[model samples]
Target: MLSILEKFDIFGVPIKLKTIKKQEQFKSSQSGVIAIIIMILSLAYFFYVISLWINGKLIPKVTTSQRMIDYTTYEWENSEISFTLYDIRSKINPFTKENNIIMPVLLEISGLIISAYPRLLFSTLQVDGDKNVITIDKGKLVLSQVDGSKEDDQEDIKQYFVFFTKCRQDWMEEGGYCADQQTIDDYFSTNHGLLFLSINLQQYNYETLEFDEIKKTQFFAFEEKSPFYSQVVLQKQQTTIDDGILFSNFKTFEVIKDYEVNTQAVSAKFAQDTVITVDNIQLEFESLGAFIFRIDNIQANETILMPKLGEVLAQIGSIVNIIMLLKILSNMINTAMLESTILHQIIEIYYPQFQHVQITKNFLGQIKQVHYKGVEIKLANFQHKYNQLLEIARTKFTFNNLIQEISRVQLVLINQIGIQNIKNIFKIEEDLKFFESDRLSNSNHQIQNLVSVLPEESPKKSEFERFELFNSEFPS
Candidate 1:
């Protein structure tokens, strides 16, 4: 019997129990075609999804808005103070080899018998120029003047007092007054009587347009507040002297002040500083424990890639391809284990069995041709039994066992019902023929005696031989 699945063909492929074997070889069948289509489409979509992810294009349209958030902060600081070390000099050609100067400023603190003094040293000038020297010596910060007694040597030497400050904001807020030398002098006198230097400036005179002879030398001094002072002040000035002019105060100074720094709504930036520069002077203040730096007011710009429904379906399709592959494997296994090859083998092994059943059917057909009423009823009953047995065997064991079981049932019918019924119908037809024949009375008597001697239960040998002879002689 055919299974429900086996009853139909889809896409030119037979859906039989044993068809799985065909799939194992990748036959050109409906299931194989469908699987191939699924696999191809699924893989295509899978790759498409991957490409979208790579290009960052998988985000859905609905999720484009970002939620705004508020954050409060306190105490903004900078790692290195942003203060100008020098006013941009118009005459200083920094790129020219003749005027370009590289200065090394060292901040050093001496140890115990080392005087506990902080020193600033100018190294290259003492070694190469030999024109002047600046250092912290004997607990005093000093600057020695350059000797340019001759007019020719005067123009090469330049002098300036360097000032540095701790805070950039204070310098900007003070309206430049904090840089005034007189203000620094007054401020210094109140704090301590610091030593001050008075010297003449000659190199590259801004007004004279030429360096002239320096006619005087002077000593200057400043007191150390503390090496670890959280706030320190610096002053830089140029000294000028002439035949008609008297020595006077220098230019500018810087001072540190103590005030409460405000902290409030500070936005944070999620970015890096792209430009970096070095500081001319760096301070380490033992008075301040920590110097905190902050970069704020930056907006957060986080992005996420979200897949669309189509992309999700594509992913599911890829997964379904895997299931299809598994199903193919399952089909191959079932074909190997359960699908019947026995039917084919039975047909080959039981050829004679089917031949015997065919012979019995032929005999029943002959009995029908005779059209004897009584024998037709018996033949019909036997034929019904024959058909039933054939149905049972074929339905139960499938096509493979059909021939073998039919042969067995035919043998039983031939012995019990089929042969006797066919012989009886043949004998009745011969008797009717004998009556209708234009034969002698003796021939008729002989035929009647031959029929009587054929016993109802078991016929004699002579009588059976005579019946065969009469059957052969009977008209068609």
Candidate 2:
């Protein structure tokens, strides 16, 4: 507590301590609350952004389904079916003993039958893992009626059994002939129990004998009128010849099971000697099992749901908001640091004192009161004292007595506070010098010794001697 007579001022400026403390506390609390609220709002926005990303990935309901069509045409006269035979275990044809000629039989049939007919047969079949297709070595001929039923064998349909090799044009006229029993046996052999058969149903032009327009084949369609095509597969079968002396391992050739043929409903029309009709067809897929189907006739309608461009941009802008929040926090911390430093410096400006006073007897005994007190006078009471403190802060200490109190305090307080903070509190200038007490004492002792060398009292001098000494010292 300060006496009413004691001056309370800093650097000639009066301060209302109670009012400053109240106002500063209010400001600090408000600042802290505002900063916390801003940080919470920023964190909420960040969580909102993260939630958007989570919803985009975890929710499958956001996807949309659409209807589509495929407007593709099949030319009956242009389409073809090909049969290729491969020896699986050997690079050489088993019968011919030729290297790199494993394909012993190559049969291709082109006309209206392959295009219009739904069912065709190959006698022997195997699957090629590398090519991902079923191969047919030799095959019986079978035809399907327009009503999706099989027709009984007829002589004319049997004559259609031909070995048509496009690579060997000179084999016969019309690219092939009917194969005899000997020819079939000589070419196809399963000695190694490994044989492969592959057949491909595709569209080509017979008149031009060249490829027709390559249109997109539909794997699926929206309308039931569209034709769905499926790739054929090989089912296991066995054939023994001469009581197992020679046996052929074969898999029956079949298209994908449970596949529906919708081409029966399509109307076939002849125009300019070419069969033309718009139909949806499915191409058999091997690995994925499910097809990304095509829609026939009508274009697909698609709907997509996504965050708007502005929303995405706003989410990105949250990063900037976070940066600004951090900046605000940093500024608040810096202001707090600066205020604390200033407060400490103001308190340190007052020299603290400890005094012993006699106190009235307590319940136990009479007590000695130890009072801790700060400087009694302020700048207004004794302006010179404040000036002295400021001078001491800015200047070097030349004498040991001048530095005793501050030196001891500095050493004691160094461990309790940061050096920078302590220096700031004391308003210590960089130019101020410090000396070790031992060194200062040694210097003082040396000075005392030099002084002691001088005589205790100066000899009495006459007026004439004093005049002569003055003339020698100063010739005037």
Against the unseen true structure, what C-alpha lDDT does each candidate score?
0.32, 0.32
Error of 2 at 73 (Å): 6.7
Q: Which lDDT value does model 1 have at 314?
A: 66
* lDDT digits (tens) for residues 1-476 of candidate 2: 57543566444645545434555332444456667776777777667665654444311112323333212111223222233333344443222211111212221222222223222222232324333122232343322222433434321221021211112222223423334445434443433232222223322222332224432222222121232222232111111111111242222222211111232222111111221112333212111011111112222222222344355557658675765666576567557544543433543543221111112324322232311232122223233433454465434333564487678777756644446555554553322436666555556544543344235342334422322211232222
**Each model's TM-score, in the order given?**
0.20, 0.25
Q: In candidate 2, residue 133 scores what lDDT? A: 22
Candidate 2 whole-model C-alpha lDDT, 0 to 1: 0.32
Clashing pairs in 1: 179-253, 195-221, 196-220, 196-221, 197-219, 197-220, 267-297, 268-298, 269-298, 343-400
Clashes of 2: 16
Runs of candidate 2 with Cα error greater than 4 angstroms are 1-62, 68-87, 90-183, 186-315, 319-325, 348-476
Single out the weakest 10-residue window by summed lDDT for candidate 1.
267-276
